[model samples]
Target chain A: MDQRSIADVTVLSPTGRIDLDTTPPLQDCLLPLTQVASAKVVVDFAGVSYISSSGLRALMLGAKAARAAQGRLVVCCLNPAVAEIFRISRFHLVVEVQNDLAAALAALSSSAAAAYRHG
Target chain B: MTGKPIHMPRLRLVGQAAEIGPAVDTVRRFALAAGLPPESCDALALAVDEAVSNILRHAYDAPVDSAVTIDAAADGEGIEVVLADRGRPFSPLDRSPPRLEGGAADRPVGGLGIHLMRTLVDRIDYRREGDVNRLTLSKYRTAALAAGAPRGEDGADDTGA
Candidate 1:
C-alpha cells in the first residue's frame, strides 16, 4: 500500500485487504504529503476490493488538506463492491470520482495545467 | 483450561469458503430481527463478508479444516459484530491514509480495507486479547456517538463485483 507522484498527480493503488491492520501504512504515506505538497491526489480503487470507515476518514482528511492547499482530491476506477460504497456515502459530492485511471489523471492534469496557466 | 463460553450469536461452519455466504445470510437475519432496517442488513452482510474473507486468507489460509466463528449482537441500541481468529495479530487500521487525490502513478498498492471499514461502519474498535483477535464494529439506527452514517434501510442488497 503506497502512493506515487506522476507529473502533478499522485496515484494511490492499493491491493490486498484494507482493514484495520493495513490502513495505517496508507495514512502514514499521505499525512506528510498533505502537509507538504498541494498537488492533486487521485486514488485509483480499480485494484481495491474492499474499504472501511477508518480508510474513508483518511481519504477525507487528505482531501480536506489538499483543498486547503488549493488542490483537489479525486478517486477513480472503483471496483463494483468499492464503487457501491462511494455511491452509498455520497462522496462524489465532495470529491470528484472517475470511472478509470486515465480519466482521473486527465482531469487532475488539466485542472492543474489550467491553474498554472491562470495563476 | 476451558474458558466459559462467551454468550453472543455464534455461527460455526466448516468446508468451502463459499459456505460463508449462508453464514452471512444467517447474520443478516439476526440483524433484521434485532430491528435493523433492510438496507443496514445488507451493509452488515458486506462487512461480515469482508471480515470473513480476511479470516479465510490470513487465519485458516485456505482449505484448512478449522471452523470460523462469527459472533453478533444488539442491545436495543446498536449492532455489534465480533470476528475472532487465532491467526497472527494484524491491525488494518494501523496504516497511513491513501492519497485519494494524488497522481495515479504515485498511489500505492494494497491497503484500502481500513478505509472501507471506516467508511462503512460508524465505529470499528479492534483488539487482540491473548490468542484471539477481536474486531468490534458498531452501527446505530438513530443517534450515533460519532459521525452520521449514510441514509438507507438496514438490509438493502447491492449488486456488485
Candidate 2:
C-alpha cells in the first residue's frame, strides 16, 4: 500500500486482494486520516484486483470517521470485479465512488471549494 | 434439462485466510470454464471467499491444521459450490443480515459477509452430517436455464440474510 498527498487530498493506493488478510494495512492507512478534521481522502483501487466484505468494512469505518470529522472519503479506480462487488454491497450508496483518480480529486476539490465558499 | 451430471474439479485448501486467494482463483477458472459470464464468476468468487474466510475465523477453536474442500458442479441451471469443513458446526445462514440502510458509522462492521453471500447467490443450504459441516451455494444461470430445472428444495431455512 502507498499513501501520497495530491492537492492536499490524501490518496491511498492499495494493491492486491483486500480480504481478511489484507484489510488491516488499509485500515491503518485510512483511519488515521479520518481523525484529521476536514481531511479529504481518496482510495485508489486501481491495483486492487479483489475485495471482500472485510475490505468493505474497513472502508466503511474510514468513511464514518471522516464524516464525523466533517471530512470526505472517496474511492476510485475500481476494477470491474471490485466495482461489481461494490455495486452488490451497495457501497456506492454509502461512500462516494468516482471513475478514476482524476475524477476523485476533482470531486474532493470541488467539495472543498464549496465548503470554503459557503463558510 | 440435460439430465446429465456436470463434473467440476474439486479444490482443497488449508483453513487459513491467506489460502482464500488460490481457492477463489480455482472457483473463477471453474466458473469461466463452465461458460458463466464474468460478472457471475466474480460474484461466485466473492461468495466462496467469504464462506472460506468465515470458516477459517469461526469454525475452529484452536489453530489445528485442517482442510477446506470446495467442489463446483454445473447443474445445467447454474453453478453449485459445496464447501465442506471438519471444524465446529456452524450455519452461516443462521446469522442475521447487516443493516444496509444506515449511515456508514452506524453500519455494523461484521455480518456483511453473510449478507453478501445471501444476495450474490440464488440459494444456499447448510447441513451437519456427523463431523462435516457442508455449505452448498447455488447461483442460477439467469440466461441459460431461465425455465429449466426447478430450484433445489434442500429446505435449508434461510430465514433472512
lDDT of 2 by residue, B1-161 (tens): 23465767777777667788888988888888887888888888899999998888888887766668999888567788999999998887677667777568667667889888877777778888789999998877784553353333334744232
B140 Cα displacement, candidate 1 (Å): 1.4
lDDT of 1: 0.64
A5-44 in candidate 2: lDDT tens per residue? 7767888999999998889889998999987999999999
Please report, as a residue range, the 10-residue window in candidate 2 chain B with the lowest summed lDDT. Answer: B146-155
- For model 2, the TM-score of its B chain against the native B chain is 0.85
Model 2 clashing residue pairs (backbone)? none
The reply for model 2, stretches above 4 Å from the true place, is A110-119, B143-154, B157-161
Q: What is candidate 1's lDDT per residue for B37-69, written digit by digit as tens? A: 766766776677667756666665446455466
**Cα deviation of B147, candidate 1, in Å:** 3.6
Model 1 residue runs over 4 Å out of place are A1-83, A87-119, B1-9, B13-15, B60-63, B102-106, B143-161
